[model samples]
Target: MVVALARKKIYEEIADIILSEIKSGKLKPGDKLPAITKMAESYQVSQASIREALNSLKVLDVIHVKHGQGSFINEQMPLGFEQNFEIITKADIANLLDLRKIIEVGCVRAACEKAEAHHHERMAEALGKMWTAVENNELGEQADYDFHMAIAVSTGNPLLANLLEDVSETMIRTMKETRRIWLYETEKSIQKIYDEHKLIFEAIKNEDAEAAAKSMYDHLKGVEDVLLTNY
Candidate 1:
């Protein structure tokens, strides 16, 4: 008797197939991928699913996309990154969120008192980038992280900033997963998350420490709730 494999999302399955090809040396580095339409036909999935898989691979730096050209495998793949991506469990995400809440909530509260003009400007810039990315139908994970990082920097505590920076990679991965899930769930979900960020920024700008803390907690809690429930 053989045990059946666990079911994965269609896009994830497609991504895994592509990664296997790469690992097996069938898809060499810097080699162009087949056209999305062709890959869709080959896999018997929609073109949209192929696109999603390609985008996920791109995020992992396994592939690089050139505008108006095509996607190609990265010349130098990050060692062990795929293993890291595959092993991230819900429990890991939950713990990451818990850590974020503890650090970020405190950081925002301190930012309300210590933040300067430059820090606010950086936060605003990050927010602008996030809005633009959303409008362009891209995941603005970097911008989202930048916004929180700005809060951390504004706290006048180098230790707090260092701690956040140390976990930046994991945070980016989780953010990508969270945003991907939101995009798949509803068109409005990403916008709601952006709104939550805006609320937190507003509280910080107004120097309302209590409100800042509450907004940050609520935003992260909302994320935790969605991720835990869905994944």
Candidate 2:
């Protein structure tokens, strides 16, 4: 009964211990985790407890469990989540965007190549909503994110979809900050963003990798330009 009541917390503590190992490179990706019995012994916990912990990690896209083979660490984080106990701050959002760009440009190309009619439909729908939000003269952070997430879904990779959850909060905040600070000075900036998104949507629908990548890059560059011009 005590163990049952403490189950969730125990899972988190055990996961933290293993997650620490993974972050330190002590347990590199593809390195098989210890068997349940060994991990139980090492952690001084029951096998059932260890299993519960592992299951939680699996749901977080943190581990791979194979039939007959032991579980193994996944390479890098699923989307962009997960770090060791390493402290990250609000100031780190810029660096996070850079990292996202580095990894996601490749995904853009892949998605462009494999895009389907339905994918274009999704992006188009989101793009329309974004334009509506733009004309409504307010921040359209959710719509903006939805457009990009549509592209991610087009990649046919659920892992990528799960990975990008709400990562735009920082970007959204920065945009709002920049927007408010420069509302008077930066004329027609929001319209420009909508136009850039249109170009990106068209490129992806056409399955043009170079065009799609370039268009998306240009959109991000426009946002960076706002940062420079306003700040």
Candidate 3:
């Protein structure tokens, strides 16, 4: 059983407790997590807090949620997942977004040419999930990350896919942070971000490499601008 958490940073503390359980082998990979209500009771926090904790874990690729089912530990967790949660400075985030712009812009161009039907299906599925999350007032960070990863996979370049996977933990963290800024600190709506992603997906679907690259560059640059200005 998890211990009750203090009021301060309650959701983050709950996430850490769950992580400790996973690291201790008490919650093995593929194990189904307790129901949100059960977790809230165990942690002495609200169900909203429990959901937030699970969402953070999901963004980090430590867990995966099945709609209408429950969350589960990811079958393949990121390497050194526990160590990757170190504090990230704003400068670090800015630099990381810059690197993403360089990498993802090129990846989308290749995806426009190489993406197969199934790859497009995966991107569409991710976009659908993002829309659902947005409508439900959730961060939808995992779906956002999945959309980008689908683009990388669509590139048909294993090295590019693997490179993105290697840095995924940090990438998801920044995504969540940026989305939080957009949702809470600014006038931008999550719906607008979803629309930007749809524009990228449309370009890729149409097999327009130049358009896809430009869309991706514009999307990432927009994110970078908002992140740096607000965070």
Model-by-model lDDT, in order? 0.85, 0.69, 0.84
lDDT of 1 by residue, 129-205 (tens): 99997898787989999999999999999999999998898788768667866775544568777898999999999
Considering summed lDDT, which 10 consecutive residues are worst modelled in model 2?
84-93
lDDT of 2 at 183: 48
How much does each candidate deviate from the true structure in C-alpha RMSD? 8.1, 17.3, 11.0
Put the candidates in lDDT order, highest first. Answer: 1, 3, 2
**Tens-digit lDDT string for candidate 3 (1-231):** 999975647777788888889989999989999999998898788998787778667656688766678989989886677683543445666788888898999999899889999999999999999999899988888999999999999888898888889878788877876677677556778888899999999999999989888989999998888766654
The predicted structure with the larger TM-score, 1 or 3, is 1
Two-way TM-score contest, 1 vs 2, winner: 1
- The all-Cα superposition gives candidate 1 an RMSD in Å to the true structure of 8.1
> Top lDDT: which candidate number?
1
Assess the local accuracy of residue 173 in candidate 1 as a C-alpha lDDT between 0 and 100: 75
- Screening candidate 1 with a backbone cut-off below 3 angstroms (N, C-alpha, C), the clashing residue pairs are none
By how many angstroms RMSD does model 2 differ from the true structure? 17.3
lDDT of 2 by residue, 1-231 (tens): 355453436656898888878878788888899999999999898998788778656545577666578788877664555643322232344565565576566667878888788888888888888788777887666677788788888889877766666465555545554444334344555767778889887777677889988887766766655554433
* Local error of candidate 3 at residue 58 (angstroms): 18
TM-score of each: 0.68, 0.55, 0.64
lDDT preference between candidates 2 and 3, better one: 3
Off by over 4 Å in 1: 1-22, 25-86
